[model samples]
Target chain A: MSTVEAYARRTARRGWWRDGLEAAIYLVAAVGVAFFVASGGLLATAPVDHLYGLGRVAGIVAAVLVLSQITLISRAPYVERVVGHDRAAAVHMRLGKVAFVLMLVHVGLILAMSARYDGRSILAETTALWQLGWFIPAAQAGLGLFAIVVATSLVAIRSRWRYERWHAVHLLVYAAIALVVPHQFLEGSTFRSGGAAWWFWLALWALAVGSFVAFRIVRPLWLLGRHDLRVAAVETHPDGSTSVTMRGRGLDRLGARPGQFLLWRFLDRERWTQAHPWSLSRAPRPDALRITVKPSGDASAAVRGLEVGTRVLVEGPLGVFSEVARTASGCVLVASGIGITPVRAMLDEAHPACTVVWRVRSRAEAPLLDEVEALAAERGARLVILEGPRGPGWGTAAGETLAGIVPDVAARDVYVCGPVAWADAVERDARAAGVPAGAIHRERFGW
Target chain B: MRGSRAVLVAGGCAAIVGAGWAASPKELPTLDLVAPSSPAASATPGATPSPTPTVSATAGATGASSTYDGPVVTNARGDYQARITVADGQVTDVQAVVAGTPDAQSVQINAVAIPALRDEVLAAQTWDVAAVSGASFTSPAFTESLRGAFEEAGL
Candidate 1:
């Protein structure tokens, strides 16, 4: 192996192990913080009933922090470096799923406990206390929105349709996180009393705001200052999508891989100052990097209009969906809709030992199908197209369902992208067919 | 410094004006002729020949009446009934009798200021004597019922 490839392998291996350990440590810290805060005896000699109420509120706040910590840590700059991009991302996505579950429990317990004193149905009482009531529903809505994003980004969901579109929609997770803030402040009893509660809340707010600043603003600005990549070429596909090729002085030295995405902040007069994640469709070549962005959202739509020489800020080489990890003897690649962007990049590298399963609603909707098929043919990997609905008779033609078609699916590692639900379904199906949980990997395109 | 001096002069003038205001009685509706009845006058009966009970010597020294009096009657069963009467805002007589037991003394007030006192007590606006201890039920009820009758009699 080349020195670069060896370095990449070492980094990937260390990251895989460290990511699990870091996540575990963070989990313990989060739970410990919650338990300590909930043991309200340290504060005051309150009436037993009042103490119980106070303890319950403290527990809720702690739980929220635990979740917020998971989200924040998964996206932390240092943590990302240690875990590498894609492995860090996998941890981030799984933690986010767990956080949503915790958030649900926190909100439910809060409403139920609050109902005891208010002497009305939880809904009715909350409505009467308008400010407090808003938090419960808002938190619920935020969790629901997050769940939708996660569900759609699942492997099975991404294997079906436009991966780019689902990826763009998945950015709503940030908005969901933002929505949870007000509920924490308004309804949280801990916030009412100052001192420890005040500091705790302030710390949480700072962490959340700090993460946003780091991810959305600070990191982008830092990247812009250090690396100046200009648009080298803009290739428009027949499917109303365009790819912007960025070339810089030291693009290859940045050590980005195919299938790894970057937060592209274009510096055109019209589309400047907006950051969006785009998959690096082509592998890192010296002085040149290519990101194929489908004309889906505000940022991507402007990619086609960018001047050839316009400067752009690239914040990543983020995401763990790259082929830096162990290469299986046989692999099944699933792409739903626009989720094929990353898969296409992976296939471009030519892992001939892999089997590509491209799922789409209609043959016409598959934008990169020809290129994907051509790559598959060139690499000598088996290509299977599961067209239309796979109903009760779905598995008959393929001799089994998508899961069954790949009998070695359990043995082979799987990478999924697209809508959260698609990923979830695919992961669920894959696991059911005896796929080891660790082998079935996924990268969520969520903000 | 000038502002401070101005404030100090203004404060001095205000203090002088306050002193003058404090010195003046300022007109108030006179209740000098109608004085508060004395406890002693109310306790005695026919102590003076005047229709209004004589102001007690001690009351005059204190600038207020010392006693109050009304009426007293006896029932056929020898029960004592002290019917206290008042006229022209002064207690006139308090006739008392003991019919059977010394402990069971029945007191009544059919007097001028006494009726107002009774009205005030029964309305629970005030208690003339700190509510009678150990006889809370009987004492207040008896006093309150008599006060009601006194108010009806307009004396």
Candidate 2:
């Protein structure tokens, strides 16, 4: 069978399983709201009752989406493999925005509903929110923290601040969720003990938080134990980029593939806390891994100065940008600037007939050019270097179309990694050239 | 593919909600136990009445007016208990022994509801009466508890 058909067939099974889990997420939430309805939620005729119901549903949905965000970023292997870390984080980010909206509505409606019931004004009910049970304030704080996180996470705001700042604010999402739990049981209409809603909600929370702890925290710690990763060497490239090589025992057991990335935390006193997501710049061996990065960010900048044998930790081998995800027999690997890191790695792993397209402002700007050319020559593959400032889209200033650069582009799987807007343009050109959506892959790390 | 996945998710949610609606016992099954002379009105038999759990009835220590507390009736909302005071077969006062709600609607409704229902029970001197509007759950539970209190008073 052709590689495309075999890969497609394999992913078809995974697609079903992934879709099932996705459906379960929605179902759990729907059932939560539905339990309220079946238990006379729909019977609310009064304004106060109606508002309460609306607020409760909003609260439940927001809660579900919130937990879903946790699960998405938890680095669950199945989720990361099927959806890819980028896609999962993308959905996670979008869900955070929606959850925030739902939460605001929840707070407003509940306050209004309470005012209606208590025969007071909305302003009058504000004090009662704090005076009520601890969960009330907790829910309030959860909403506030989500708002602050969302505010700081906006692209405009996020770019102005450091990634660590954004991330630290983001961690409050977990604290927010923890605070809201008390009210959900004590005051949540559907969460009476031993009821179907109760069990469903309890189970849903258990799954969300449990998956988070297991995947995000426990799994990484376990990998740290099993693999014993350390910085083998750090090399600075001519283009002001650095490649950090790490030697580890039993790295093959980690199941990492080419084009995949890991969250690297160099356990140095200067920056042991910050983690950066960097893709392997070369194919992985059983004993070693490598990642090339531009020194644009603080942590990336520190890569060139790392001492030899420095301890390291990783939560990785994540992303589905691999040969196994290919939907066609022929392949085209494309990269620009720092984006070439993964494409270089994939060249070693690509089939002999594959093609490589590397874009750089100048020959000096492209990191690993010699290695890339050598790898392409060794593999008997086609290679193209578009050395010039990028034109509109993922093209060089010479004004070359994607199809003009790659032979029979429509019949091959095209993998491109670059700036998001540039990648989107490349995808646009690929689709325009009749490349099927299934055959086009893009690697993006920032969520 | 994204569209299909969304449809699948929505469909699954609908099916789950449909199942919950189906599985939900909207109405309480008929209880063979009779409504005793005490003023315990029926909370929705929907929650199964927690096996006839009774709240302690407090009696007036001294005074012509005697007081009695009612059985605790629980629903999806929470537990409820009512107290009724009578002077020589004449009900003078009725108060919710344990009827405050964590929710605003319940509290607002009960703020007016329990007292209004209490006045109705006192004027009528019977548990059977029209439940005040907007506080249906609390009214019924209050009536049932009032019945238990009346029985305790031996009226």
Candidate 3:
């Protein structure tokens, strides 16, 4: 079979998995509301009762979205494989905003309805609710924590804080979820019945939280135990990037492909608290994995100072900017500045009809240039270097369209990894050159 | 694709509304403004039917009538008491009353639950009825009170 045919079949199958995952999210949310309806929520006649019903539905949807947010970021292999890590995290962020808003609506409507029903002021009803049971008060506390987490996550606030601080605040989401869960089962009329509705919620929570613990926490610890990875050597390049080579046993078992990144935590005193995402600068071998990090942040800068034999914990081989995402026989790999790490690693295993396009300000300052050039020559692949200041197009020269350079650009899959704006320009040019949207894969270099 | 997405959204909304409307009861039970029946006459159950009611006699002349108020049961929410009226060895009516610290939420819960509990008790003619939904405190209190009333009547 030809490469395009095989690629087509693989993508079609993967497309099903993506569709199924998306459909599951919608289905679970719908089922949540359905449970409320089954409990006769829609039968409410009074204005307060109607508001109470709305609160219940809002709470149910919010619960579903929250669970979904957990599942998306759980780093579950199946989810990452289907949607890619970047897409999953993007969805996670979007769902988080929606979930938080619905949560507020749920709390507000429930309070208003209770106040009206009891013929008391809202403040008085809140006090009464606090005295009602332990779980109600616990849920309120969780809501407060949620408010804090969300406030810190806002773009304006988040930009003001360091990544480590922002991340520590974000971890409170797990605690918030734990605190809020008890009231869902204990207080809701539908759930209290201990019937199908109860089981449905129980199973959903188990599935979501279970995946989170199993994949995000357990799998990494297990990998750490099995691999026993430690830094073997560190090389500082002329362009201010540091490449760390780590030696480990049976490293090939990680199933990491070229152009994939991992969240690396160097277990040193100074850098133990932060895990930075860095792509492998070379193809994985049985005994070693390497990462090239450009010093963009404090944690990244500390990579240059890492001592030999420093223990390491990793949470990937994540993302889909690899051969697994290809949809054509020929392929074009494009990179700019530090983005060349993944592209260089990918050249080692790319298709025979591959072309490497490196766009940089200067050849001497480009990281991993020599390695990519050597790999291109060894594999009989063409190389194109565009070095100069930014131009009107993706290329550094005027009228240098993708089609003008790589004549058969439309016949090849295009893989782009770089700064967001440069990558966007490359994608626009690739599309203008007649590349199908699905055939153009991008791995953006930031959170 | 945009057309399909719009259709999908519209269909989802319709399904949700349709399912909710279908699941709802034909008519919701409205809150009763009138006070419940006052305490019935308390009397021993007789093997032979006879008029033996002493206080507030409102029953038929033949059957002996007994009504007992269950001791107030306290839960986290508040206190609940069950009052049951028995005639001819059958519990004809049951009322769940919120006593102390009647939290407004509990009041709303009892309003909906009391009627459901009454139907359950009348249908079974016993104290053992399923707990009403959303009335965790009131259901058990009502059951405890009804059980005491039943034992006292010796039916």
Candidate 4:
């Protein structure tokens, strides 16, 4: 039997998890609306009642989406394992925007209805709402914080700001969520009526916040105390890339895959507050793990100057661009520029039937070509190199289709990593060549 | 794939909402605007009469006239206690002694709703009047307390 069919069967069984988790997110939001209907929302006949009812539904959905957003970024192991970190973050971003708009709608409709009912202006109603409960004002303040966070997160704004500054501002989202929570249970009539609805919301919140505290914060601290990871060696390549190897005790228990990236925070006086995501350039060992950085930004540029003994705090073993995501026995790994970091590590762990396609501006410009070539030769994997610029296809020449290069590409999983446009082209070619969507994996360079 | 997922999500939400609607209280109790003592009146048993009245009616000169305070009824909004002054077996006056949530919205709602409810009960001479519109919480709470007061006054 061909290895392709065998591998297909293996991967087909695991595909349900991603779909199931995605469905669960929407289902949870639906349950929120269910709670509202159960609370007689449908029976609201008057104009004021209708406005209030719709506002309540909007509030419920917004709150649920915010919780989902929190869960996505919580770095929960199961979530990361299933959906991958990049996809999770993308969904988080999408939901955050929707949640924010719905929140504004909630506030608007609620204030409009209240003002109309009370025979008062919107401003007067705002004050009246403030007087409703102490949490109301706190919730308003939370909305302001959320606005600020969203503003700074805009593409134009984020591109200009340093990552550390943007991240510190981003942390305000947690506080926004915290401030918004009290008014939900204390003032919202659906939750205020102590019953199954209330308990359901309470449990949902506990799950989101609990996962965040446990996985994002507590787990990193535990790793620091337990593994005691620190920089053991730093290597600077001729291509202006730096490789830092960190040695830690019992790193096998860290559970990091060969190609996964970790958010690294170096505890140097200058770099402690900034954490950058860097992919492992080699397979993890029992005592050490290594990451290579090509300085594209301020934080990454400073990595070459790190001292050997610098303590590293990490939140990861994240993303699914690894063997665990493979669906076939034979695989094709495609990478460009510094994108080779994860692809190189992944190639080291690929099956003997694997193939490597590396695209670079020039051989000299390739960051880790030596190590990758050595690994490819050792593993007996096919190696293909394309060097040039301005290609009609993913490769350097026009009409260079993926199927033409690798004739059996349809039966194998194709992993593409590089700049966004380059990766998109590769993915498009892979799809056109008859590879299933599930069999085509693309690792975006940055979040 | 994104389109299919959205359809699934929308379908799932509709199903959940359908289930909630199925389980919801189907019939909102419409107020039976007729006095219990009137020959033409057939009171909705739960709306006008409490099975166990908590207060006793004091004696009056003309058949039965007395003041009765209903037992406090609590809901999500807040506490509600209705006081009734009965003279000669008729409900002379009704007042919501405690009626509203701590929120300004609920307070404002009750201010308008309570007076309308009082007029309804006095005109009907029973607690079986319809809930005032836009005051879903306060109206039900008011009627619940008024029902207890009616049973106490034996009217």
Tens-digit lDDT track for model 2 on B16-90?
A: 778767865553222112333343444432233323434333456565565666777765344577666677677
lDDT of each: 0.55, 0.76, 0.79, 0.80
Judged by DockQ, which candidate is best? 2
Per-model TM-score, in order, reads 0.50, 0.81, 0.85, 0.81
Docking class of 1: incorrect
Candidate 2 local lDDT, A1-447, one digit each (tens): 875678889878767777776776677678777887776564443444677779888988988998788888888887888888898888888988898899888888888876655455788677655544567777777777767778888953547677787788877877877777878877675674357678877887788789888987788888888888888998998988898899989988888888888888888898777778889999899899999989887778878989988878888788888876787788888877889888888888777868888778898988988999899999888888888876866777677777898759999989989888778888898999999987888868563
Clash count for each candidate, listed in order shown: 53, 14, 0, 2
Task: List model 3 lDDT by residue over A309-365, tens digit each.
Answer: 999999988999998998988999888888989888888887579988888889988
Error of 3 at A354 (Å): 1.8
lDDT of 4 by residue, B49-86 (tens): 23333443567565665667665665545556677888
Across B93-115, the per-residue lDDT of candidate 1 in tens digits comes to 33221111111111111122234
- Candidate 4 regions with alpha-carbon error over 4 angstroms: A1-6, A45-48, A157-161, A397-399, B1-12, B27-94, B97-155
Q: What is the lDDT for A244 in model 2?
A: 89
Docking quality (DockQ) for each candidate:
0.01, 0.23, 0.23, 0.21
- Per residue, candidate 4 scores C-alpha lDDT tens digits across A53-74 of 7888899999989888888889
Judged by DockQ cut-offs, the docking class of candidate 3 is incorrect
- Worst lDDT window (10 residues) for model 1 chain A? A39-48
Cα lDDT of candidate 1 equals: 0.55
Q: lDDT at A39 for candidate 2?
A: 69
